[model samples]
Target: MIQSTTPGKMDRLAAFIEVFKLRIAVVSTPHASSPGSPALLLAGSEDEGNARVVFRLHGFSEVPDDVRVVAEVNFDNEANPLMSALPDEISVPLGGSVALQATAMAFLSEAAEGRCGRSAALNRLAEVLMLMVLRSAIDSGAQQPGLLAGLAHASLHRALVSIHEMPAHPWTVDDLAASAAMSRSAFMSSFRTTVGMTPMAYLGAWRLTLARRHLKAGEAVKLTARRAGFGSAAAFSRAFSRAYGHAPADLKRAGASAL
Candidate 1:
């Protein structure tokens, strides 16, 4: 079934952003080239940064030469699915969109002013910039199979969003197909084609991703395992070690939070 292309289609994406915490800071301009170019650069790999966002602006010829805004952002989690699913570089030219241009100018002004709470304000602006870029990316779609490809699909996004919002819902192929409003075979075929993984496999990976987050925050193995729908700690540890090349305990930090 064809789904609406309107605004609410992406409503569930907000949950991912909520958990996908990132750090934004203003960094010095690395080099001077192509003034009048305002672009958003996303880090391609874990080495660079998972969800790192860099918005660099060399003021357009129309604006004063003094305005230059260069800021870098880093996402705290390496396992952010949104970043993992995207290509190495998604450049958004601010000049293309009137709304984006206005926002970029405001961001640049905020960064240059260094007023009270400048850091906080800049971070918020960076978020707006990131959101805009993400929307563009989702609309443009990806050539390869991944989350972006799946989300860009009208029917598939519903199931993907459901899976994302409730990773611990004990999802199955049939259930996921129902969520997507497709037959079991059709859903499996489309999901695998677009996401490059079977529905159950993606669910498992997503669960492990969340479990690792909790483990790194000092949550106990058994607690995380149970919450992740694992039968026992041993089973969970084996899967975790295979996926990350380290035991879950190795990720635990100094303090523990309520799991």
Candidate 2:
């Protein structure tokens, strides 16, 4: 079920660079254990900075004490290099059972339309919030900033960018090495050292992530495989199963895939 690994896999992820166009949404609710329900406020929109941050407020009537989120969990590009280096979850407490929730998404039309589309205030707000969360996390000693700092290396960063920009291209160590202006040996060693995996292995992981998204969208297994750079769905399924512990069609059926 193994397909030949190539640089094309990274191209799929490159599309996410436009995340600034998304909007941030916030929802506030009271905790159940509180004696009195708290007031709630939710606000969001599509605009730079606005879309990157979301503000939610909750009020408690009787409780004099408050719970607070002293630290945040950030996941901005400037923060980390690992594509999926995120904590399982983060919690922020509001005094007196008040809660603030933040979420973000790009306008459907803008996202589907193309780049150069209008960026939403909500998107900017979301970005800001993300940055804040990560900063908070680092400040609170909840996570290691060193992990993210290390990912900012120039060669690895450029390699990541190249993969995201051209996922469909057939890529090799030689090609990537040329792109990074490094000898093949140096590139291979550096990439493995930084990412903790071989270049081909990273490519395979990227392809699988893309194929899973397409499958969940009900695009059909064969089409998903081809688009993700596999020659056939059978090959995709085999690779998917090996990597994720499930068949490609199973992802389609579950409908729990991420794009």
Top model number, TM-score: 1
Where does candidate 2 stray beyond 4 Å? 1-14, 17-23, 29-83, 87-124, 129-151, 255-259
What TM-score does model 1 achieve against the real structure? 0.76
Candidate 1 has an lDDT of 0.69
TM-score per candidate: 0.76, 0.53
Model 2 lDDT per residue over 1-259, tens place: 1112654322212344332122233222213323221122222333422222212212333322232111112223221233234333323331112111233233233333556634444345444544444433332332333223223454554565566555556778888777667789998887777666776777777677666657766778888888888767788888989988988777787664443
- Give the per-residue Cα lDDT of candidate 2 at 65: 27
List per-candidate RMSD values in Å.
8.1, 12.1
Which numbered prediction scores highest in lDDT against the true structure? Answer: 1
lDDT per model, in order?
A: 0.69, 0.47
